[model samples]
Target: MTSAPPRVLTVAGSDSGGGAGIQADLKAMLANGVHGMSVLTAITAQNSLGVQGAWELPAEQVEAQFRSVVDDIGVDAVKTGMLASADMVRVVAALLRTLPPEVPVVVDPVAVSKHGDALLGAEAMEAVRSEVVPLATVLTPNLTELGPVAGVELRTVQDRELAAKILLDAGASWVLVKGGHDGGDTAVDVLHGPGTRQEFSAPRADNRHTHGTGCTLASTIASYLARGYDVPSAVGAAKQYISGAIANGFALGGGIGPVDHAWQFRGSGQ
Candidate 1:
């Protein structure tokens, strides 16, 4: 038998729409050449339009899924998304703490859906800040999510950098403040870490069906990290991967659709 490929685990909710959350993470991971696993934290009655209803799983179930995967298959990296409640956030953080120090963890602070529907509870904000942020190897947050977590309104790139600093200081080894909501000809994402900063700008894809951009980017980063890329290199590679995915996004339903995670393979006949 051949050797196993690098493994990455995503701890997130299930998106029934298959545009974001665990579905997106797995797709991104596979696109970037890693075996993806998941620990489902919640189930959402979501579609292209918006999230209709959501049910958070018991904390014990979440923990059990995590343990069952890690104890047997093992993992090279991990990414996290929508933990519905404060209890779930704490539980996920505690589970992350049990991982080896070297395993990279990418946390996508997914507070809301692409259509502006809330995915995380307001009560979970503090739990995420106090418990989850610190455990993250790389924290990925869009401007709206960053504003609340960093307690500031971001209007410029400088503001984003400052917000990134706040998250970095909160204990995340690196913080990527996404500029997708900034609305410009260029989409600039700022990655800030200890004594280092990098700006990754991609031609803002003129596409509206970019529903899974956040989850895809975070999982791509985790996938690259699992492939042994350094933090900066991993993030840089993920930026390129996501830009392509966004540029190739296609309409799925009546509302927004998903980025094509298999964009690279589309015309290659793979």
Candidate 2:
């Protein structure tokens, strides 16, 4: 019998648009040859335009979901995004602390959507900075979202590396500071902490259908981690995967769309 694929769990919010949040995380996991699982922290009324509404799941429900999965299916790695509230962040952090610390955790502290919708509140930002990031195996934050969590205002690529340093100092074993939001010819992401310092650069794909790029990157990284790849290698491969996902992304709605997660499935063997 064929064995099941490695499992990767994402504890995040639901994106109704199916572009970002848990939807994108699961898709990326599957594309990278992993079994995907989720523990949703909130439900987002998201669209290509923006997030219209959001409802956070009760802390009890979040804990129940975590226990249900970790107690049975058991994940090799996990990625987190969009906790929605301070209480939710704290709850997830506590639960994660009880897990085997060796299980890699990719924390994507999603503060805002690609369409500029506010996904995280100001109060919750502090919780993420203080509680969530401390347990992260690798913290992936976009340039716009980096300041609150990493506490470094960025103006250039050098600034982004400094921001990564701040997050590493904050307790993450590694920091992957995404430089896509910064206007540039290359989309750069840097990972540095402990004994690993890795940098990824891809020539800008010039695609507007970039709504869920951040989610895809973090999920891909976690999936690789689940498969037993080390931090630098995992981040490097994920960078390549997401860049191609962006290059071939298809437009679906009037506003921003999502990356093409299944690109590797195309073409006959050569």
In candidate 2, what are the lDDT values of residues 87-206, reduced to their tens digit? 999999999998897899999999888988888887898899889888999899887898777766667767777777777777888888887976779988877888766679999987
Model 2: runs farther than 4 Å from truth? 155-158, 267-270
Candidate 2 yields a Cα-based lDDT of 0.88
**TM-score: model 2 vs. ground truth:** 0.95
**Candidate 1 backbone collisions, by pair:** none
Candidate 1 runs further than 4 Å off: 268-270
Query: What's model 1's lDDT at 258?
Result: 92
- The sequence of per-residue lDDT tens digits that candidate 1 reaches over residues 188-228 is 98889989888999999888989999999999999999999
Report the poorest 10 consecutive residues by lDDT, candidate 2. 261-270
Q: How good is model 1 by TM-score?
A: 0.97
Best by lDDT: 1
